[model samples]
Target chain A: MTSTETTPFREAPIQPGDLLLSIENLHACVEENEILRGVSLQIRAGEIHALMGRNGSGKSTLSKVVAGHPAYTVTAGSIHYRGQDLLGLAPEDRARSGVFLGFQYPVEIPGVSNLEFLRVSCNARRQHRGQEELDTFAFEDHVRETMAIVQMDPAFLERSVNEGFSGGEKKRNEVLQMALLEPLVAILDETDSGLDIDALRIVANGVKKLALPTTATLLITHYQRLLDAITPDFVHVMAAGRILRTGDKDLAMALEQRGYDWIEEADGSDTLQP
Target chain B: MSNVTQSRPRLWLETLLQVLAQWSGGGAAGQPAGARDWGLPTRRSEAWRFTDLRCLTQLDPTRLHTGTAAPHWPEAFRQAPSGQVSPRRLSLQLDGRGHWLSPQGEPPPWPHGLMPLPTGDIAPGQVLRTVIPSGTLLPLGAQLNGVTPGPSLGLQVSGPDPVHLDLAIQAEHAQAWLAPHVLLVLQPGARLCLNWHVAATAQAAVLPMVEARLGLGAQLEEATMAWGCPGAAFLGGSFIHQSPRSVYRRTNATWGWGLSRDEPFVRQSQGQAETHLHGLAVARGQSLLDTHSTVYFDGPAGRLRQRHQALADDRGHSVFNGRVVVPRVAQQTDASQLSRNLLLSTKARIDTKPQLEIVADDVQCTHGATVSCLQADELFYLQSRGIGRDQASRLLQRGFCEEILQRLPQSALLWPSLQSLLETPVPDQP
Candidate 1:
């Protein structure tokens, strides 16, 4: 209703492949306004994809819709994870089945201890994976070992979850959860947005260490600085709720050098008026 | 409408008056109980407006049990797993008639720094009466206590060492209506930590009034956990008088009562004292819980911090009215009151009023109230972590209660009833 783009666009037909996640001709909305008009993407195991877009480019909406955020309504879309219809599952079921969305702005839950939340979350995923649940003592040992990956202080475990955390500290906590839950498809939505130089390096390194051949990572960000630390196999430029171009990491560097307006100029339209 | 239908409260009041008269010879020497201004609180009373007393009035008054019965201490109080006594804590129980007994059913001797008040000192109810204004009507619980010939306890806490006392008050029989009064006097430089864990049977009433006076350089930390059954009501009152340089901290967690009301009033008599009041109510089912708290800074340089929280689910209702008064003489007084409430269902209700009446120019007073459902984002955050929606909601509710529950006494923190408060149906369990 606000912009020019209203029709759905399918880039190509899905071919038979061992893809971990496949999103074909996705259209989603929040409230009554459509955010993702028609977007298609594909990710295979062991690949790290970087989704580059400017503000209001539907990057975050894509991540939330993939994770089954209740607020976003998928009007027309088909999402398949491991050949299973992903949209049919609840958010928790998706999470338990190894889909993780690292929120851009992690919610702060007051009075919920960070350690307890982490253990419960980890246990939920473990149970789904046919693993025994860790009791409080065992979980502490496992979590302490995992905390070293994010360089998080043990004091944070005693505090309310993200209640008074600084921006960098909160991002680190998101990565900590990623390590604990061990999701197959980790959507890091702007996980490096508010980090400093040192924190960005630490977080990028953590993500790099966690990326295994059996898992896939979708790094949603605007800048190429994060890619500099953890090289993405492919970088896709998203505009007008659709992927405008897909290329290697060089595209991210080019966009970083020229800014996002360069992508609009190449596309020959000012369609990113969100 | 049938005559009995419209006269249920009237009949209950009439029977209550007769019972009080029979218990107290007559009211005030030949004055009839009905003429002595004894009646159940009506909606006309602002303090009782949001609280429905139907849970109390609907009970059959002819079977109201007033006799003392030995308390059956919950499993938590049974000798600990180690079967060892805690040297730092002295445990006691109050029977239906208010007699102090050990966990094994015998009266225990007062500890070193604690002793029973002399027989000639001020009576148990005298201190509470003085705490009220001259013309103000006494609370219904205090008035009933005045006319009922129940046992009372008065303790004088002194000496340098701190005293830790755990008291359990239980109405173990159905239809038992208990009216017990306690007076605590802390001398200068004295310290006491008192924990009260209370439970009541079905169709019963547990009305307890506690009056305390803290001298200069003294400290009193009091915590209470009250769990009530269906058709039961808990009307508790606490009046504390603190002298300068004294500190008084009171934390209370009450739930499961069909109708529960707590009125705690504190007066920093000469100010320069510190008072901390914390309360939590987990109201579910058709239960109603209300807390009316007031702290008065009568002189200069007083400090007060109070927080009250409630969780209402099903059709339960929770009400809180907190008032902090800083008069002109109480300059430089610093006080803050916060009332936080949660409504878990569409039919559940919560009413909170944090009132600060500051007449002093240089004083700093802040008050706030919030009533809301659990945060949607918080629940989603938990759910996205693979916790089920129901488990996530329960976790958030438990998190909400942990803030106040952690402040309870050690014994109360371990009580199974308090632990299961969020899990079980309130009307069915204590």
Candidate 2:
């Protein structure tokens, strides 16, 4: 097959107010156990959504199911990306079509140069956008410029990919990837989990900078500190593998003031529904 | 019945002994007398238990003799434009036989500071006797080499400038068994970086025995690529003795042989020296690759560091036995040995044993071995970045081997085998 025929490139740039992603009744499972059960969400271009839930509430599973993680099987669901069937594509195809998943725990790949990985990944995305692939010299300059967004040190470029990086550094690297890939739908899964206050601010600012009018962001977090920084347009409260409540930024503040138990107590009917 | 069966040499071993006995007649004048009878060790021996030598019996005894010079250079070495030599390095070719072939398929003049040692210095059983006492059994590979001693290249490396030398040992024909020997003596304060490439095709076998002695404050760096074709075998090793204040570093990678075994021995004669040994083994198909290395610290204040890695696929087997001995007299010794292996197929096997014997109360020693498959998370992380699964696997495999390959000399990049070794296709499951 020809390159263009197999590659799932973006036909047109996303515009503000466009429905970039639509996950309807997404029922997914890791092996035999279902994690995301009948969960529904929509992400529009130019908007930010925060998925807040207690542990085991299937927030990360929904993100992974949308990003096409191999371990998760979409048992019964349909995901449409840019109005195209996203479930039939491979993980790489999903990634090339402008879907990015910032992993909670970024894997450490020893002996693989971090710069080379970034360059290859960047070129793959550039090719998807019908842009010229950058050579070694050009990519070095380009990556060096992008590294500034996360305040990344040039020395990290020379080491193995996240081999010895601290938790904060790994999160920054995830953000750096996000800045390079220029995804239309970015799923930042717990990007603020292990970060210090300073790192959290840097990561949040990087995400905020990348959240263009033509792109959308889905911030998956447990606390309201990250929401305070990014100011999500919609806040989601998940319980028993479904979104029980989704309101504007005020919902996150109320949850922060009163812990997650308040959400269960306030919406006991929805929380108790199997 | 079992005792008798174990005592009896196999048919191939008997044939090899007879062939070596015949070839030993026309070899160097002062060849060792009893070496002709030194047969290879059987599987009954503890060291040879994991090694299977049934592949040797398939060779024709008549074709085992060496010294048939290739009509032309191997295709891989012919790429260099004729008559133009790189100033940064020097290259020499050994034609499976004992003779060194110049780049143009003729005998070449020795470069400065890298001349052959005088014939008077060669003892009858020098390599064998140095590592093992008389009447003591040598390892199978070393034993095969010691039996049929042939023309040897013994050089004394001495000069102010560091020497960068490339040696290509190529065996081109079928059933051609090469038993080439090399001896190197580095003078005090001298430095030498030698890269050796050993290639044999068809059913050919190469038994290379290299011995080196490092003087005080001297440094020697050796990088070797022992790449063989299927139906071929490599049974070779190096024996090194290091003096005080000296440094020796070796990185050896072997792959593609039906059976390849290396038993290199290093002795810190007076201690206070530094040793770094890094090795990588790539085993696929039905190949078997093994490395048994021993490092001894004889005096006080010595240091040693070693890392060995192997990748096995198909029905291939990879074995590593690293031994570090620090006795009572060798006080203040510091040493570490780590073996990492990646097994890719259900049938593939990897056996690693890091034996550290330290009796010195004040010394520090550490050793570890880990066998694993590719990390699913690492692969998934790459795939999530738009890289295909196959490409991601290749990247991870390259990363696994690069730790040792990057430590090789810069000149090693010129060899085409190094590229092919890295680009080896990932194995498919049955």
Candidate 3:
């Protein structure tokens, strides 16, 4: 309910009911190379799950699969979000249904201003909930407020979306959108990869601020530093296209202190029980 | 000759001969020499090659309404924000035959140094025809201006002194044909801002011919928007002649009509003149739009920058042909042109040709054109934030057209109206 909800940090495996997302034996690929192989996970309403894996371990693939990236094909899997088949819906439909993805490499759209984009997106979300759309004046105020969470410069609002922006600025822009949309499930796919120390703190703080009791987050990252900034309830180590082990935040520290080799050696997963 | 029904090309030749006859003052007694004749364009002619006028053949010219009644100009043209170099507007309306209507109340006092050329009518700004030069044997749409039979009045701003002149043209009449000629002459050091808002309301045809001559050190900044109602068509040619040290900049856009063709020609006869042009042509709903522009440098040390954009959705088709010529005598000339086209639907089409003809060894010229659809990733990016695909497309479309819209002077910016127009749905397919 608060920014410091990770306090009294409990080590609990995912539970049933109040289930925000359920991925059962998800298998996906791009071209002919299979990236996600029989990956299964579940996230509750008030949970922050961290997915860590080695290069080509399918952490990013799982995030994209959930976001409905057109590039990846699901050979066999069922993704249920809010009790509906998420895979049957288009990416935009998935988004309108309260799903958000903070891309690992956020796209640059030239000529579309950041402010205009935010207003359009926010108004769309509002309209879906049967609320009236905000005029330019009202939208400007709303966006200016949200932009402060990411410490984004107001001038960036006039600039083209992510065009000519630094890596830190793009990440901040992603968090800014997250704050504006306030989605039910937010996937930060390698959002910390190119960010510096200052940017990482601001982004992590913004995410922490936006997390609500009814909202869930999935952070796909390789470092334990991001976990240290915004503590996760569950940390899963993935290897060879499948999540090998699931544990508390200590798992991230363990994977960082040692390596993913230990998680791979401890084979035949689905070890953690509710 | 009046009873003859000739082929379209033959008719154009006949019209040109008649114009020559009129210039020689050889018209029959009791007949006006300046009877504007609009010859329909056809595929055989070079100027009308890309734009087909076969559609006009079905409409009977004899049945055209030459109604003397004037229209109540809509509020679109009256939107000029206060306080930044204010200038007077010239309210003029013309019939299909290039004739201005009877006195529509007292006209605005002509700005100093702008003398109206002799015409049968006493109105101001209604006679839009520019006098096409009979001097050159070069190919001419000069006949288009010559054929519009109207009370001829020319507005010329001369430059033995400096003058700040603003001219605006807008149409609102229904079911009338328009063949008007507009002429402007700016002397050295003279400055002019011209705006043309051409609209053909419902089943009307508007063909305008504008000719402008700029002396040394003269400057002209012009903005134009050509739009029309269903079944309305507009076709025209604009010729600009510049002397040494003259500067010309124009920003033009077409929201589009059923059949529209705009031909603009710029000739830099003397050295040191600068030419800049920005254009947007949007076609939708079975509309056909073609813009052919040529900028020629006759003397050395001239510069030019030209950018044109086209957007077509549904069964709409848009064509752009831009040519820049730098001759042997025009050494040290610098010219660059770009054409950007956007097609929103599988059925929409765009044909663009950006060319540079450089003969001088010391000249520099470059041209490029690109056709692209809205990126799916970009669309997904906007939608991920909860924006609909349609709204996101409109935002991107506005963003695309703004590149040219930004070139308009701050004093002439029509913000609210343009903003509302951009927000309106753009028909993606017929």
Candidate 4:
């Protein structure tokens, strides 16, 4: 099996300043079971794009396929990031190239401290970019600065990587990593899931402060409440592995009021596109 | 008939005879029928199913011994009592080879109600025997020095009072075999803390046997760490018997050596007895480390818990076997065993097995084993923060060893020694 996929389609010449990621005709599956069929979306640099969908609507599968998750097979797709063929790179290579995926449920790695974990990840990226390695002092300083953005206590730095963190704390830790890595394209998978109001605000604010003109973010969520805190430049409604509608922030409110039932009837079809 | 009798015997049968002779003191003493009848293990034996002894039996046992004299107490250990900084010590040495105790010194009296081990079967060739008086609370410290090998030492302590014992053994650049036997008896309400640190040269080997008996209401805490030479071999065995209302805690750690193995056996003989065992092993290069522990509940209302963790790198190999057995009479017994391993290189290998044999219907017994590589996400997280992959792995390993290290007593002298082991190029001192 080849490690990467290549698409022949090219977007209209990039407007000197435009979105960082554009996906077209994306079809993905696992073991021949199609999950995401013909999904298309766009996100401009410095913009947060919220993707809303119900359970079993292929929200997570789309993100996984985009991140090059080994389990998902991309049947047909074209993913261009910064004028590069994203589907042609390994997951780690994608990460080194500034693509990051914040897992919905962070994995727990026992016996590996948060500090050490972050240091190694940062060093990998630095090495990939052919930059000088940061010494202990410089690395510690970096950790301190990034952790501040998330309002995380410095003491947690020594603890094992998410070994026993509470739900909200785990979400905040994910953001902490994203802040430290400074990814060009970050797919935040359910970042607001399992958070108390206080924790939600802290995490949302961290994301807001970290966003820059050179970076873009894909915010996947089930509820619109998170959008109230971190407004998205554009909102997309996904149903059954495909984008049903795309519009400004008003689309999220309309969906919240109409409850996806309207989209089901408007399509006039019970079966989803595959 | 003479010619036929002189013909070479079957290799398998000869091996059995050799093992029997060794156990029976070369046949000077009549071999016990039961011991002889046990016979060598075949594929049928459950315990030996995964391990092959054929290759081990082929090696010449005599060649395994290092004949060098033990070295003198390193300047560091000599001044350890004064808290002076010293280089690490070896686990095996030649000079202080035989069983010899330091000059007798006045020791404090032990608390009341402690029972000491009664003098019993002295091994035929025991070289030295030291006895601690009953109810004596003594702080016993000893440093075994030199490169010469072939010394056997034994100790028996009996009392109702609490006792603290500190021991260090060092060996450098010499081949030798040292065996030490320790026996402890704690009367009702007695307590003890025992610490052992061993360091060996590239050609040293150490074998130690420790046995303890805890009386009703007695408690014992023991910790041991071994850092051996590139070619050193260490073999250790511990057996503990607990009575009602007794508690026992044991923790052991080891850095890579040529070859090292630890075996601990615990038996709870009465109700309301508890035992806890925690161990860590870190191996690098071509070193091999193995640990096996068994907990048996022969009485009702007993509880046992054990945790074993290992890290292997650079073609290293680690093996762990843990078993918990509860008999029919041992009702209300609760037991658990967990073994986790981290492999740093694709060539590193770990074999872990956790087994449970329970006959009681109302008992709770659980066992688990896991072997995995470092998490990719975790590693990336550290690398992104400027720590190289190698340093990141080392940090993670140190964290893995920390849980067991926290249980050790406060000794500034020991921390540096442990730290050096965690880093590359294992230090020479203990």
Q: Residues A54-118, candidate 3, lDDT per residue (tens digit)? A: 88889888887887777889999899997889998766566666789998888887667777777
Better of 1 and 4 by TM-score: 1
DockQ winner between 1 and 2, please give it: 2
Candidate 1 scores a C-alpha RMSD against the true structure in Å of: 6.1
Model 4 off-target regions past 4 Å? A1-18, A126-134, A264-274, B1-45, B53-96, B99-175, B186-205, B215-218, B226-233, B253-261, B280-291, B309-321, B339-362, B369-430
Query: Model 1 chain B — which ten-residue stretch has the worst lDDT?
Result: B421-430
Which whole-number lDDT from 0 to 100 does residue B276 have in model 1?
A: 97
Largest DockQ belongs to which candidate? 2
Q: Report the lDDT tens digits of candidate 4 across residue range B197-278.
A: 7677656666665667777888888888778756777777666778888999998888857777677777787657999999
Which consecutive 10 residues in model 2 chain B have the weakest lDDT in total? B80-89
TM-score on alpha carbons, each prediction: 0.91, 0.89, 0.81, 0.74
State residue B284's C-alpha deviation in candidate 4, in Å. Answer: 8.1
Which digits, one per residue and each the tens of the lDDT, describe model 1 over residues B1-430?
2447646666677677676666667643444534445567788788888978888777676677665554455565677322113544567776555577677766665677888888978787677756777777777777766666666778999976888877777776777778877789999999999888778766788888889989998999999988887678998988898999999999998888999989998989889999999999999988899998889899999999999999999999999999888889999999988999999899999999887888999988888888889898887788788877777888888889888887876667776667557674211000
Better of 1 and 3 by TM-score: 1
Going through the candidates in order, their DockQ values are: 0.34, 0.44, 0.32, 0.16
Candidate that beats the other on lDDT, 1 or 2, i.e. the better one: 1
Each prediction's RMSD to truth: 6.1, 4.4, 6.9, 8.5
- Index of the highest-lDDT prediction: 1
Alpha-carbon DockQ of candidate 1: 0.34
